[model samples]
Target: MAKHIIAVGAIYIDTILTLPHFPAEDEKLRASKYVRRRGGNCGNAFEVLQQLVEDDIKLHLISVFPNRASADYAFIRDSFKVSVDLSLSIHRDNSQVASSCYVFKSQETDSRTIVNYTELKDMQCHEFIDAVCKLSPAQDAFEGWFHFEGRTPDTLVECVKELRLIPQYSGFKISVELENPSRVGLELVAAEADAVFFSRAWAEARGFKSAVECLKQNMAATKEHALLCCTWGAAGASAVQKDGGEGIWCSVPAWKPELENQSVVDTVGAGDTFIAGMLCGHCCQTSCWSLEQKLKYATDLAGRKVYEEGFAELS
Candidate 1:
């Protein structure tokens, strides 16, 4: 049987407004066009992975959103390519889904400013624990690799601890994205995660000149069984693994899309797409392959994702 993969995080309804140029302070500007779509880190990751993996592995999503037979639910249900357990999703009568308005001012550079309208109530520690526990039946514990956004430190840590208590899940791999590594109480979460992904800026902010150095400097946080990966926009990606009681570091250059006559339309959710590719590669590829090979394949997928506007067009 193929290994099961689950991703948990927030999902948002995105409203993108394309402007001719950035507006000055107190200045009014007209938008060239606008679009609405499903977004969020895990949301995009799930969408893209569905297209890439097909039936090679089982994909599942756990998230919090407004529950109802509304547009939000309809959009997600239609876009999701796998079975979803939305019982954990909080619901409000006639509630609006969590939405974001992004102003893309690409007249100069590919940049966007987001204004978020959060509606999904933050899950409490007990609520999160209950939701995770409900995923597995009484007869058997859920057995799969879990990837989640590291947003709520207290709840996330508690969830990890509770899941580890299951005898069958003792060896389960849990990966977390360090989207905001600088946040308080995240070090504890990072130490517990089996895999940690860092943005290039996050690594440099910690006084490391490169991703490999960043991983080496934080070896204490990463246990002997853990691995770390960092993505540099055009510079490519690098990884560090704890294998055979030694630290192995590998760097791979970014795939060149420009050479292929492709222009980058937008960079939104590119990192999430890369993560999705890595997850697919991990479950589908043989373990005999080196970490370097895996990173190269993921980087190539990310490069291609940039050529399109959103993950929906990955196919």
Candidate 2:
């Protein structure tokens, strides 16, 4: 049998209010649209993973899904066929969860705001592993890559440590630490993973501009295998393999010749989509692929996914 992929990250409710123009400070300007998109790094991973693995693999998403309110916060749990082990991640507070508010009309141009509406409480990752351990490994239930959207919160780190202790099996047990906003960054987690993926936005945010710089810094610092990457806008992606191979760049040009009609609704989750493609390539044992190949396919899928309004919309 094949190993499974585990996606872990924060899940939240997104309140998106689009205005024809950027809102002025304290000025009431509501001339546009309003909508809600699932706004969690963990949530975004599910959108990408399910689209790629729902029909073929036994994917599991570990997150906090509070049933305190009548709202169906756990919508994806039922919508997608994957097992959503919510015991560890779901916050029990009835109060509304905090969210990221985005205002944008262009891919590179836009502003986002984060507001903490409720006291953030999440499950201890040990709690998460304990839940998974309940499932019989003899039944071949829990084993595979554990991909985390971001790294923070001591609980999750504990969870990662425990997962590493599981008896050696055919599973990869990996974690995707998408550049986290936390001060502790992925460097700590890098040494613990079989693979670490980085996107241009996250890479730049970390003050490492190019993929080469990112790779050099992380590879030197982390002993665990790491694949430093930068998702170039329209140009595609640049990736450095963990085996100390030379860095490679791939081009994923715009979908159409016309930029105005590119159908780009939002670039919010493109990075996550790209990760999905790369994960697919790795999980499926794609042979000796040029780095450009991964970039092209990842960009194509991510670019297309943005045309939809939210993190993901099935066509």
Candidate 3:
């Protein structure tokens, strides 16, 4: 049977400005370059996954967007280079598209500062359930993978609970990303997920010094069969799989660019790229791969992303 991977999150149109340096208070500066692209946690991940997966595995995006007739909606819809099932997406009438503005300072370690604006309402638990119901059918027997961005923790918890109640979704594997540390009740959502992806910023915010330290302390909150991964920027990444009341840990070093003295280009969607790589390794592989392989594949893909401006040529 074929497999299905669905990602649920907000979609944004990103406006990126590359400047020589960040401006000080009341200072004016000219940007060196301007670029616009489709961006979001789920949107970026699906982009990379589209290139990594074969034709057998289908990709789907569950997001909120403006009216179908709007130009913003058209741009987003036409941006995907590969087939991504957006039938499950929700459209809001008389609403503006969610957008983000990023300022990349070339003089300061290739850092970026972002400001976001959105007038569209977030998808509620009922809406999520409705989309899943429309996608699931009695006669279809494809394996399902549901990934949540963990943006709205309360709604996510309810959605997960409702999914568990549906008999048709019993065989589905669910994953959740815990990217924000300040989001209260995210741990509850993580506890319900079969796989959880943690960010380096989240670990430091929670007072954990290392990726392994964070995973080890949080292992008790997950299911016995749960898999946990944490990505540390320059330090590489690590994973801990819970099995038989024990945690199996694996770590891999960060991948550096092959070109000598090549500065990092862009770090905008690196985390999303890493998530897509891990998902690709798990979903597209014919046989089960070791933890080391999974980490390396994801880390290397993300490393490559940093050398380019966008996700176009990462695969």
Candidate 4:
């Protein structure tokens, strides 16, 4: 049986500029490298998982893109066709694809600054449910998993409710990436997710001292069986499983740069890649591995992602 996975979000056209150092506010600077590619939390994760797996699983993506007639949409379609199953995406006429410009400074501590613009509308709950319902006979019969970027919480809740109502989808696992803690309605969405992922920054901004603390505070709002995980860039990753009985907290050290086989160049999409690696582990070894071992595998895989330039390089 082939495992089916779907990632839902908006895809972006990314313009990455690498510089030796960040320029002063009033000064001009030259970029040492420039590249453009398709990126988004879901898209990046899907691409990484696609490259990591062989032919056993089917990777699917449900994203919004400009109409096929648009040059930007054509470019993205052509570029990612070999990497994911985008047949489930939503396209709108006269729509412009979301775009982001990132400036990466290579001096001192490597950091990235991003500015994004979007004209695309958010994905609606019914539209997503409808797309999944319309899957072909073959795809419809397979057991699957869903991963969504946390956006529009109410819509996600409604979508999850609809999915659960389907008799054949009872075994489906739903994971959500809490991309931004500041984003409204996180509590509502987290309560419904089978698994929830967060970032250290998102946790800190909410006045929690650590990811475990943040998750524990919010775990009160989640279902009894919900599991929460958080990723700290250099510090490490942590996970707590709340099974309605007892909660177990576990943490794993992040992969250090000194242990990598390749040279570090870009840190872009590393976190997304981490989500991919974790999801890969979840899909492959759901019952066998301990949470600590899974975290180590994910962190190590993400450590290698930093050595590359873009998500596509994983192939």
Evaluated with TM-score, which candidate comes out highest? 3
Off by more than 4 A, model 3 = none
Q: Model 2: per-residue lDDT, tens digit, 1-315? A: 545666776666666665566656897765466666666666676677676654445566666665545354544344444354443344556644443444344223454444534345566766677656654354554445667766463555566677767664335657565555454645666666666776666777878766657666776664444565666566556666666554433444634434575555666767777777777666654576666676566667777777777655532
Q: Which ten residues in a row have the lowest lDDT in candidate 3?
A: 96-105
Candidate 4 lDDT over 1-315, as tens digits, reads 688888888788888877778777897888888888887788778778877776777888898777878888877777665757878888887775544545455555577777777777778888887788766443455676888888788888898888888766778788888867668886677788889888777788888787677777888887777878888777778888887765887888867667546567778788888889888888887898888778888888787787777776664
Residue lDDT tens for model 1, 1-315:
446677877777778877877778998888877888888888888878878775646676777666576776787667665454455554555565654545464555567776667766766666665655565555664446889787787778887777777675665689988775465676677788888888776777677787777777777777676888888889888888887565778888887765666677767787898798778777767475678888998888888888777776775
Error of 4 at 234 (Å): 1.1
- Candidate no. 4 TM-score: 0.91
Model 4: lowest-lDDT 10 consecutive positions: 96-105
Give the range of the ten consecutive residues with the poorest summed lDDT in model 1.
82-91
Greater-lDDT candidate between 1 and 2: 1
RMSD of 2: 3.6
Candidate 2 deviant stretches above 4 angstroms: 72-118, 136-143, 168-170, 244-263, 285-291, 311-315
- Report residue 68 deviation for candidate 4 (angstroms): 1.1
For each of the candidates, give the backbone clash count.
0, 7, 0, 0
TM-score, per-candidate, Cα-based:
0.90, 0.81, 0.96, 0.91
- What's every prediction's RMSD, in angstroms? 2.3, 3.6, 1.4, 2.4
Instruction: State candidate 2's TM-score.
Output: 0.81
lDDT of 4: 0.78
Give the winner by lDDT: 3
Question: For model 4, what is the error of residue 258's alpha carbon versus the real structure, in angstroms, after optimal superposition?
Answer: 4.3
